[model samples]
Target: MTVPIEDVRAAAELVALGLRTGARPTDANPYGRLLERYRSQTLFRDTVDTVASGLGLVVLGAPARTGLVLSTQPGSVFAVRMGDLRSTGMSADEKLIAGLVVLGVAAYAFPQEADLDSSEVKTVEVAALDKFVRDSIERVLAVPGDPESVDGQARTAAELYRRTAAFRPKDRQPGPAKGCTQFAVAEVLGWLVERGAARQMPQLGASTFQLTDRFRLLVADVAGGEALEAMKAVRAGQH
Candidate 1:
């Protein structure tokens, strides 16, 4: 299902807010507004289970591992993963990888991933994943918009991610993921990373991510009251 470009921009901006503030899914930060918006819209209700499974894969990476590398709370991996799969046909498996890519980007944005003390992620092919994520962001941008403004696109991406994460089950395992107890969010994240829409930093924590710079620039281009405010909040956090 295609969404308004402005909406996409708004959504991306919201995620960026979370990134800037180091806000976790469980945090009561302003990012919760994005979640509230999606819940009100009732988007991605049909295939929530699939998306959850995909996100679970992202938490574990391409190959299932003994433990997650990221330091997110128990349900966080699921939120990030599911958020990436919003509104896309990308299956549960595909989304799982996508969520992983989000985690990779998050790690890159922050310095927390380096602290993970796990051997499950020892190798990282950065160049390959970077290219994949860039291509995916471009495709996401290719969607037509009535206004074609930066705010349109940024909101869309942010809200999409927020809704995907919010709709995911908080506890129950949606399905088996690579021999692990995967959820829809993980499955969706896995799908995106594998499909080249996003990239993953496997050597980093499950919460890590690196959205293509192209996606970042697009997000930077948006200029809405709420979007700009969110950006300000992020910038303020950096200091």
Candidate 2:
């Protein structure tokens, strides 16, 4: 089963915000290290393409050809590419939902790459995707038990980190903004750092970060190195 896209988005924002300004896991507790891993010490070498593939979805860098693939399980959405092979028994609505989620995520991951923004995603206009993800998990668990379903949520969460976990020193620096994008990226990277999936690169400068061996290992463990290579290949493929 597929997870709700909103949950994925919220998780990204939560991780991002936590990294940028620090996290308070509980209301009573002032500060929680839930995202301490994302600080300068850790990194997430995995790219959005890697994450998409990890979820058993076909990934393409082209937005015009990508779409979301929804599942009955919570956090089961996939970002499929246009020309990729289709999964068996995938419904039309499921494909539509998945397309929306993938597109939405891509808009955020590749801000400059896409013409869309966070506001353009249309999966959960009436209801927030985060609430849907949580609620869907609750419902699924009540009906029939599936551990993979639950882990799918975690995978989705991990994908959140994967999407925005790039080591863009140019983009990581503090820039003038009302909402704070650079800070958010820093915060997310901080979480990856804590998770042993990322590391800071002093050579890049005070504001930059790069991936470590541990980060590469984590991506391979979860999604395989094909996706990782795809993302890195992006740089080499560049003119």
Candidate 3:
């Protein structure tokens, strides 16, 4: 039997609320009053999942990794891979390289890849990866492309580098980065937090974030097989 349109609208609202607020629908609280009325957790979850999938995302726990998807759009906060990072003057080549640099750092530092959830990652390892990522980004940006503009390429890389600082936790109060070569890896880590994939831990002169269970579950499907290899190749470009 077909479901009523009202039910669909309510479900959509619930999905938005749950993702934005990170509240699971439950029978007791008003959080999921509709789901409670229906008396079905599976129904509510599946409905939310369906909505997320339609938007090229997958809702994990409420408010966590709220809308994690690899795709980028016109103005997605997820990454710079989407439309022009700025209004204009940025070349397609710059966009592609900058995106790859960000993507590489994210993939390598992924809890699934680095397994930060189960083990403590050495600070040296984190620093090394950051170096590799910055070098890779600069290399790609520096490489001459069709109708290349050296000054434009350098400027793009510099902008990306500056934006990298945008990721440092406001609380940590990190000082200014020396230059575009800096990782500002914190940005990727912040992205992880936004996606509910990881949570920040106490720092001892170094940064670390604990991976969440949902991260493991989601990556198992999206970060394995061919997708994993492709991600690896993207990261390898930095090497």
- Best of the candidates, TM-score: 3
| Clashing pairs counted in every model | 76, 33, 4
Candidate 1 lDDT tens digits, 32-142: 555445345554321222233443421111111111111133465424335444554655444444443443333333222222322322232333333333333433334
Residue-by-residue lDDT tens digits, candidate 3, 139-238:
4444443423533444355446535543232345563242232333444455555665566666743555655554454444343333233445545554
Question: Between 1 and 2, whose TM-score is larger?
Answer: 2
Ranking by lDDT: 3, 1, 2
Least well predicted 10-residue stretch by lDDT in candidate 3: 63-72
Report how far residue 238 has shifted in candidate 1, in Å: 3.7
Candidate 2 residues 60-137, lDDT tens each? 111111111111122444322322323344343333334223222222222232222222321111112222222232
Candidate 3 pairs with clashing backbones: 22-62, 22-63, 65-195, 65-196
The C-alpha TM-scores of every prediction are: 0.25, 0.26, 0.47
Cα displacement (angstroms), candidate 1, residue 232, comes to: 3.1
lDDT of each: 0.37, 0.31, 0.46
TM-score ranking from best candidate downward: 3, 2, 1
